[model samples]
Target: MDTEFELFDDDKSDVNAPPSYHAVSMSSISADSVQCEPSFVFSKAQTKQIRTTVLSLIRGMVITPDFILSSVGPTLDACATSLPAAEFTDILQESNIEGHTPLYWAIVNKRPEVLSAFHKFITAYKNDSFHDVRLACMVTNDHTLFTKLSLTSARLHKMERTLNLSLGCADEIQVYEGDTENQFTAKMQITMFQTRIRVVQKLRMEFIAQGRIWGLLFHVGDDTRWEASIYLSKHSLPARPKALLTVEAQNEQHQVLKKEFKLKEGCFLAASEYTNFSIRTCTSTSASLGSWPIFNDTIYMDSNGTLHAKLDVALQ
Candidate 1:
């Protein structure tokens, strides 16, 4: 036998190894490879501290992103309770960085909870003066959420109801000169409704005539009437100088509705040396009537029964 020993790599095994050493190695490897969880988890004491800080900030009226983020829940509650009705109005008037108010932000964010709080505030404030309330109601469409909120809050329901009634009861009226036909025919029309009614009641018209003219007044039922006045100038001018024709309507109580004027045919020489000839309809209260000058011209009536020129003037 040879004195030198031959070493075999495959035979190198520790048959008596203990299992505890292997278990320790595996546990150490797992501990090293595992990732630590995120840090958003709040402890009980930390949560209390956050809530307290938020309440204090809200009470102090500190509205900042850092403040809000730190105490969003409590601050939101405080705004709903203390800042809604009165403070919210001030916030609305004060524009934010985006040229918008808290209400605008609530609308943009679609924050129903915040919107509901503001809606309640608006309804209560509007009760003292409905004008601002009506304006606010019309100001934006974000009120859909507010309306839903109103259904739940008794206070808002009343405010919205009154606004609806006010909008419904308003009425207005408008009037204008229809058209003229070759210094022969003139017509006027009136439109009435809530927003324009008061303005319409102050209307008046003054007609300046250059010659003898015919006038007619027609009253279309519903207490509305149309008036036409005509006149001629005394000069045999080559071209007709423009004439001013005016028409006005009065309200139900005989108050002027609206005054409108139109420039019609050019001034003509008066039929006589008297220098001035004019005529106005006496049937200011009549509903249906018609008038035409001695000159030949086509006449058409508008929806309001005001006469308008349908063809060019024909000098006979």
Candidate 2:
């Protein structure tokens, strides 16, 4: 049987504790008096000790994995630079009290901090080749029915919410909520056809002359290559029915790379069929569309600062 580590409620829990490279200083107030919580330091030796303790606790089912993960989230972040990925990965793979993997727990519970730590671990240890691990995390043999139900529920809920937000609003210009310059913005994820599509809506971008616009990142087939789409509101500008739609990317030094598409038939820009507008910076290094960096955040402001455009992202 694995030994279970005790949780200390008060200061001096670990009296005479030796110092180490990384330590968490905590304070606790007792009923009788105020007391400083004992500092628990984690060094190389301490890490090994912690690994043994955690594995034992997990196997013994004395403490829940989620609770343990949540408790040590900060520790993981602090040690990310120093700890090897394989070591941390082994630690996280231990099943939780509920028999769920750490990745699944992080995703289902929406534990952003833990999830971030996991991402860092994967990036460092797996070198961005975690697709197989991701697939494994999504599957479990013990609870097929429950997992299927959860997935169905999530999918339906997302579709229902999208439908609610997008109904009767297609092609209509809506003001971006957060700021003044964003007169148009919409984010959507469409997954009906097994295709992952991310849409970015930008309105009145500084470079563009005050018009409702859109951009898309499409991931289809098996390759990492993704195609982009640009669209302009059809009914938007009454006076100027058509205009040149130019999308440009900039380097760190602000050098512009430009691509242009023509707008016609009351539509300033259509899908890639009409023209190809390349936004070079919108590509990602990952094969999975969900891992693509384009969806991270796209907010741009021109030199003069008079006009601005914010990207609204959707993943399908």
Candidate 3:
């Protein structure tokens, strides 16, 4: 933070006198002047005029190009005023000077008012351009704008819909085989955690309703012994908890295939012929697998039955 005042030598001060009685003077003062500078004042009518001018210019930039040249000062002052909620999406979506949007000017000038107006406009329109507005808001660290946009029901719905649709389209799951030296390595990437969990739950329920066991291979280690589990019903499954896996070492590799299981009650029984192996040496071959009941990724089964991998199509 910078200050407006400057320090100067006070030549009139009596250095030897008591501190309370000491006098000080600066070089630039007029000795007879006893008044301070007049404060700035604007009449209500003037203030209204200024706001109208500024808002008009802003609106013009959005709906037309005639006001671009005269928008600078008025737009700034309007930002400094308390005005009615205004929509500037048109400006963001339409106004461009050689590829530069009005948002560019707003950020460059550090105009929170302009940015806020734009944010409100974007949220209302629920346009694809909201992404750009979001990025700009983040870059500017505009808390008010960010919060407003983030809390919009439309925006939230858009995000959820996108995640669900992507999950539905997921196609490939490849379990990378590692070397024997790195048998414990099980890399996991759960791109959309909540969505993926929901999909898995739906799949488990569908399998149980049909009296079929959901054959899932939980990779244990280099030991080639695995087991399969069967889910009995959806209501029996445990509520999915928040889960995150960002590293290979964090994966819990318990190679087992259970049968006749209830999700809520946990695995009921394990398959008699279980086989587990080191993920690194399982097999280089990648298989074309089916989509999970609710998610899009194709499920790939490794030759060694030790690892399972899914390619994230949601991100694409």
TM-score comparison, 1 vs 2, better candidate: 2
The global Cα lDDT (0 to 1) of model 2 is 0.31
Ranking by TM-score: 3, 2, 1
Model 3 Cα lDDT, one tens digit per residue, 1-316: 1112111123542353212211212111122221112213556674444343433344333323223434444443334333333423443554232233455445434665555555544534434344434434434434344344442222335454455466553222223333432221113333443243343321111111111111232221233222122211111211211111221212236333212212222222222322222211111111212222133332322322122332111100
What would you estimate as the lDDT of candidate 1?
0.30
- lDDT of each residue in 5-69, candidate 2, tens digit only: 22322343234322211231211112111111221345557555444433433222222333554
Kindly give the stretch of ten consecutive residues in candidate 1 with the minimal lDDT sum: 1-10
lDDT of each: 0.30, 0.31, 0.31
lDDT of 1 by residue, 32-92 (tens): 2211122145565643433333233322222222223333344444433332234435543
Model 3 lDDT, full chain set: 0.31
Residue 297 displacement in candidate 3 (angstroms): 16
Considering lDDT, which of the candidate structures 1 and 3 is the better prediction for this target? 3
